[model samples]
Target chain A: MRSPGSRLRATITSYLLILPAGAFLSVVFLYSLARLGYISVHNGNTGLEGPAQIDAYRFIVDDPLFRQAVKHNLLLLLSVPVVTVLALTIAFVLHEGIRGWRLYRTIVFVPYMLAIPVLGTTFVYLLSLNGMLNSLLQTIGLGSLRQDWLGDPSYVLGSIATIIIYHELGFGVVLFLARLLSLPEEVDQAGRIDGCTWWQLRLRITLPQMRSVIMAFVTLELITMLSWVFAYVYSTTHGGPNFASSVLELYIFNDAFSFQAPSFAAAAAILLLAATTVLIAIQVKRTSVEVNPE
Target chain B: MHGVSKGARRGWLLALALLASAALAACGGSSDTPATSGGGTTSGGKVELTFWYWGEDDAPGANGWLASAVKAYETANPNVSITVVPQATDTFTATFATAAAAKSGPDIAAQWATGPVLTQVWNGAITAISDLVPADETKHWLNTSENTYNGKIWAMPEYLIGVPWVGNKTVLAQAGISTLPTTWPELIADCTALRAKGVTPFAFGNDTYWTTQLMLQSLSSVDDVVQASIGKKSYTAPEFADFEKGWAQMASAKCFNDDVSSVPMSKGTEQFAGGKAAMTIGTDGNVRAWAKTLGEANIMLGKWPTYGSGPLKDYYNATQSTSYFVTSWSKHQKESAAFLVFLHSAEQINAWYAATGTPPADDRFDTTKITGAIDKQLYSFNTTGPQVWLQNFFPPQVDGNGNAPAQQLVLGGQGDAAAAATTRETAAAQWRAQKPDEVKNWSNFHPGG
Candidate 1:
């Protein structure tokens, strides 16, 4: 062990080492958060002379579109589980050394690597009414299944969610595959020697060991669905066919940029941040308990 | 022994510091350069001016005309050099807004006709173009009221964009119709006659909601719509109901293309361009564009069919398509005004007309330059019967949030007149709440002599 003075000196050095990063965070992130909080109460469109109004918060809370946007985001959360399971299943298959697995992996991961606006635009064209998807369906004698994928309010949110899942599937697969590849081979060998079936080995050993990774991915997906879908919504439907697919971020943008009501947008942003933070906290707490029951 | 000697280490650190300094300088170089660029007089004492504009993609040959105009201006005045910044459509407004807020944008920037101009003027971001250009010259531009504020014109009108109903005469002839519709009854009959022969009467991509709103504007007085926007008249009034009923009549007649709702406005408008639909109503820009596809001889342009029969029946949905304003912070206002005046000159206006086929707002743009019959007719209508555009008068939020979607809802059969009207009123109420000052200063505009 180091002497007391030496340990103290090292401690001081560590503090000195972190000072730059701490100062940066305080100035950039914490300062912005503080400013956002300030603007959330004050009118953001006006100068300092503008009166403070808590009514901005009240207005957003009462707006039906705000409620609708929240409901749409929550509904899209359903895609998280579906995406997670589909990715894990595919990753497991790839890990089993399936034929052409490398090519398959590359093809599957391509969408995640592509820019969101490009993918969203491509999907918009493909899913449009006179687009190739519908034309192909009609050609194949599946004409009855033809629907207005983007125009119908009932299905618009679902369409956006579907696009989100399709884009995010590649990311989830890559993440799970990375973890699966790094896992020990001995556990699988031991399970096989103990007469465990393939299904049993996966369910009993592999999945249990992957609990932490799965939880982390789910938390990430949850956060993403909450905050990271503005481009898809903007480029595709523009939150329309009558505000059917309007998300919180789109609402904030419309308020701030379109309406010139930056105060209301600021308040809405705070609510979105608070809601996402609460959900993420609950997920993190649940994950920690699962990882360490003692 | 493995470590570098003390001298070598110091040398390495010095090199690292120099590299960091270079990187910092590189980053600083970009932001330090003002968006409008430095504009002090050159060593030869020539003034440098910066100009920014958007919409080259949508208005195909605008950039070419602007560049040629700049070259012409620079050649004529050897003491001046102009730099034109063509901005992307999506980021133009927001970027300008940010730059204007910082008081550090281009000396001259293109602005949309009314709402955007009004917002900028309200914020005191732009100088009145009238202050630069003479009144005699300013009086020649069309729809000056749209950008007029506080007894002065805030922007220089560039081109006139009229919303007229254009037709593919070949498509109409194929449907056994020889003449264009001129009256409300004739319009309905035409819709029926075309549909009976398995042709859509109108091609509408209802995504932008212009399909329904433009039709409504055609069927009603433009003044009523403007009054309704500013709370002087209600959308639930009898006139709007009649308009809605007329829209329902067209909807029941199946006037639109098969996949109208599913397609965007641009894609839907293609039906007419492809000769699938007999007619479509749109801005003069689209009309000029379609003229390229369906030969100039095959295209026909006319005012919307008269609904009730009044002066408004003859009025065109006319406004300055876009305008340019001198920034309040510009150091070279006089030099910038000189360039602005150069754009309105007979030579540049002719070049603008030749390149874009858009009628220049400057009356000096010779009508003899127009070769096509349809182009001449459009110019005649624009020069004679301009009317206030309802879309341009509303606050951006009101038009975006209420008008666009409510029309979509109504056309989709999900809402009625009362519901759509209520949405409009609510949007107006929101606007009023947000900008009571603008509302108090609002004055209803009437167009034409």
Candidate 2:
């Protein structure tokens, strides 16, 4: 056995080894957070005038365009989580020795790998007035169901939401499939032997085991959906046939670069960051329910 | 328990060490420098200057013209080298902004004459070229005053841009329309005729901001108040009502494609080129692009329709300068300014006009060498009845926020000619409310003030 001094020395050496990484994390993550906070308060000014007196935050809060964007982003945020859960459930089913599952998974996930611009263009073609969707509907004797999916403000967000869900479902499936494969077969077998139904076995054993993975996937999907509003906007309607489909990310872009107000853009970005933080905090809280369990 | 704790500590240390190495690698890696040819001195020991610009992928011929011009300028000076960096149009703004932030921006950069230049000027990113450009020379160029921001000329005029009605003669003939539309009633008549022949009346791509700007300019009447607004003056007259009326007509008529928002400018141009649509409001560059796509003989250009007789009798064509500005961060300002002056000279202007098919703004440049029919129409538009667009004259944020959003209003069934007029009036009023002191003295805010 090592002497107490030698063991203490080893502990010191390990801490020393970790010091550089700790410093790096402080800079990359903590530094960015601090910088964004400073920018949010002081506005995006470079000169020695010591931050413009303008209430940049107030401008963002009051702007109609910004409010609409926030609302749209919230809708997307709400929709993605539900979609992820459904996708994971579907993925679990396919992974359960279902026939033709490989083909099914391939067809579902193929859209996820498509370039955003290409996907946008394809969707635009599909959703156009005389597009494939409309033609198909007409041929099926459902001509009354034909509507301008892209042009109508009422349907535009729904169409975009559908695209988002479809695009992200593949990654969720792949992740859930991997997690499902890693789950201990004995735990599932025990649940089965206890006379539990397939759903009960899944809920009581498999899902519980894959809890951490599901949490991770949920966080990743939420962040991605939050940030990728620009791709969807640029591809389909450019935030509109009107402001019908604007999201906070696109709103920030239009405000800063498009409108030439970096201060305003910075303000919008801060608000978006704040919103994202709140979401992440809520998610963490919900996931950590059993963290301190007795 | 002790062993588990110790093992966890060791694992944590190892993970931290790995992360630290990654962080170091990220920071230490040299950024890939965008291509720059004039970094070192040439054989003649001349000061090399870098010029950044946006151009088409197949524009080596234009770049060749630029190279020859640079060579000519070098021969005259014998102590200067001009390096040209041609960037794709989409990457231009972001690249320039990044370069500017890094303090390694081009000595001279091409500027879009409207809000982009004004926004940069407001931010103090650009240097005033008033000292570089001769006062006499500036006066001779139409709409040169528009480039002035807060009593300083920020950019030099290169070419005057105008919205020309580009049409395929064959398409029009097929639609049985003999004469081009010259008024609102005539446009409606033309649209009706074209619709009857199962052809779309207008080829518009609302995916880009420029398309919307062109449409708005076409709808508004060329009044003094409107001109004043374009010139960034404080005017009390309500002019946008007339514009809104025109907008309503267009929207109600379904003159453009339903999928306009999805169609980019290039796609719209292609559609027009392919004779799928009768006409599109485009600039000289668009005309050139169309001429290349369609045969030169098939494409024709005409002025946007006029409204009333007398001073406003002439149809208004939107004009702007595809200008160049020297950044304040430029280390070689003298050399950069000298190059800009050389570019303004008749020889270089003529060469650029010949190569790019862009009409030269300089008076000394000859237009006779431009053989294309579209070129002739552009020259005529420049010489005859042309007016600067309102977006070109206003501050960046106002135009992007106020005018750009108004495009959606028109396209999305919420606007008309009267509503467009109201929107502009309301926008002007909002501007006045926002900056009362500045609006109170429009002359003081004028670049030439």
Candidate 3:
């Protein structure tokens, strides 16, 4: 056995080894977080002003738009988890000894490789009045079924969500597929010998194994979807046919860069960060519960 | 992992710490010197000045004229050397903000007129250019007043770009329209006739906001009420009924193609050039671009329709300067100002106009050097009754003078004319209320503000 002194020395050396990474993380991420907090609380003429302290939290909390953005974000958050689970299930099915599995995988993963701009442009084109989707509807003698996908306020969020789901599903599917493929064959064999149904095998064994990956994917998707709402809203509706699809990202951008109100934007950003943190915490709890069955 | 022994790891960590220390030292090094002088030395050696601008890949050719002018300037003043760097348009604002925060921005930078540039001025990021270009000299430039912030000129006029109604001459002739419409009703009639000929009436790319600005300008005819609201004059007026009617008509008429949301401004311009459509809203500069694409003979430039009974009978012109400002953080402000003065010289202005096929801001430049018909037409438009676009007079942040959320609303049909008018009014009120102390003459209202 290693001596206590040596063990303590090794522990100190390991921490010393990670010191650079820790410092880097502190400087880049922690420093930014601190700066964000500082800016969020202060409402001076510019962000750097010290004496003028405005309660940024109160400004955002009182606004109806902020509440709506939060609601939309929550809705988006709820949808992503469902979509990720669905993707995982589909990926599990595709990993089975099914015909044309490679083709199905390729079809699912192709959109993930495409740039956001290209996908956004293509989706906008496809949903347009004179686009292929409308043309197809007309050809099928169901012209009445076609509606203004982007123009109608009722359909805008749903259309944006659909695009987001389609865009993110590919990555989720590929990730789940990789995880599914990496499962030990003996686990499947053991489940088969026990006469467990396919669903049971997946629920009891496969999903448990994929928990960490899922947690990681969930975090990544949350961050990406949160940030990407602005680009989609900007590229398509520009936050509206009437602010219908305006989310926190776009609102913050408009407030900060467009309106020259960095303090307001900083407040919005702080809220966003808090929201994201809460979401990550929930995911972590879910992951921990999954890992520790008792 | 195999190669990294414990000693090696320790050594690596030490090296990294040293590098971090060095980086921190470097960052802290400049803080010692006072930021006012920007730590620049005027020794016997070359005095290099950095210039930043948000332009395209095509800018270098246009900037090449300016660069040659700078070289001549350098020859005259042997100690100075100027370097022009063009930044990506989308990233320029963010980059400038970051640079301003870091206090390491270029000596001189191009600023869009209106809200955005005004925001910089408000934040004390820009140096006043009153000393560089005297008020007497600036008065000669038609649009210089638009770039002035709080009675202090912040930037010198580089070029004045104005929105123009551009149409395909062949398409117009084919549609049997003898002359361009001067009023809204006539425009509708013309568009209907063009549609009857199986031609797309308006080649609007609603994917971008500027296209919407084109349509909105046509509706309101850019009167004083609109201008004042945009200029943060008054925010309570609600006299934009005509603007709403225009938007409603546009929506109902399907003036834009069904695939408009998919097409960008460049593609729309291409379609108009290729004879896929009869007319599209464009700027004088765009007319030049269209001419290059479709050959100068095919394109016709006209004014946006007049809808009001204002004294300004001329068509709506979005005349704002592509201005350059000396950064307060600039190390070589004197040298930079000298170069900008050289750029604004008559010979350089005429040369840039000749190369770009767009008229120079300088009145002294001979127009005979400009050969393109569109250029001639725009020059004539400038000479005639020119009402500067109202949005250009607003603080830069309000609309990027005409670039931001306003354009987006135009494309999306979010805010009708009344709503746009109200929004403009509200924005002005907000500005006034927010900065009552700063604004002395908030009551002095012009129609367009």
Q: Best lDDT goes to which candidate?
A: 1
Chain A (alone) TM-scores for all candidate structures: 0.96, 0.88, 0.89
Superposed Cα deviation of residue A46, candidate 1 (Å): 7.5
Q: Alpha carbon lDDT of residue B328, candidate 3?
A: 78
lDDT of 2 by residue, B1-449 (tens): 00123354345334433333333222211111232333345677768888886533323256777778888988898777777887665446645654554456688887677456765665456788886666776665555655765666788776666767777888888777766788777887777777778887887765545423433333333234434444453332333334444545665676676556444556655668777888888766777778888888888778766543334345345455456888777767767887887877877887777676666667677767867666777777876744655455554445545565566566556555445444544556544443333344443443321
Instruction: Please list the C-alpha lDDT of all candidates, in the order they appear.
Output: 0.74, 0.64, 0.64
Q: Write one digit per residue (lDDT tens) for candidate 2, span A52-171.
A: 455668856876677888888777877677777878788888988799998888887898899877888888878866578988999999999998787777888888887788788888
Query: What is model 1's native contact fraction?
Result: 0.21
Clashing pairs in 1: none
**DockQ class, candidate 2:** acceptable
Q: Give candidate 3's error at residue B275 in angstroms.
A: 1.8
What's the distance in Å from true for residue B302, model 2? 1.5
Write candidate 3's Cα lDDT for B156-223 as tens digits.
77666676788788888888986777787888888788878888888776444453333334334333
lDDT (tens digit, per residue) of candidate 1 on B306-373: 66444454556777867888988887887887788888888888888888888888777788889887
Q: Rank the candidates by TM-score, best first.
A: 1, 3, 2
